[model samples]
Target: MALVPASARTWLWHEHAAVPLTDAPPVVTHLAWPPHSRSRPLAALVRTAARLAAPDTAPTP
Candidate 1:
């Protein structure tokens, strides 16, 4: 039984046959990367993660 964000419940349930603990406390997540890294793919991934973490701050078309 792992603790994960509610947003991941569906994917984890479908992909890993995992079940949620209804009484579990919420989890806080953080992302980190090298401050001087120059990987384009990693940058893109960080951007995507930021968007998902805070949809309200994501730019709209």
Candidate 2:
């Protein structure tokens, strides 16, 4: 009844066995923030998340 990432299956196995939903549509995740915010910590977190999400084209190693 829930959709979870495959990577989390093992950790959640004890709670409930995961059944692959072969026909399920791919999940899309998104992030949002106030356009004019200038919080340094939030900016860093957003940058880190973007880098992790798209590693192949990340500017730095």
Candidate lDDT scores, in order, read 0.70, 0.78
Report residue 16 deviation for candidate 2 (angstroms).
2.8
The 10 consecutive residues of candidate 1 with the worst lDDT sum are: 11-20
TM-score of 1: 0.51
- Superposed on all Cα atoms, the candidates' RMSDs to the truth, in angstroms, are 5.0, 3.1
Quote each prediction's TM-score.
0.51, 0.63
lDDT of 1 by residue, 1-61 (tens): 5666667766664547556578766665676788999999988987887777657755553
- The residue-level lDDT of candidate 1 at 46 comes to 73
Output the number of the lDDT-best candidate. 2
TM-score, cand. 2 vs. native: 0.63
lDDT of 1 at 42: 89
User: Model 2 residue 59 lDDT?
Assistant: 51
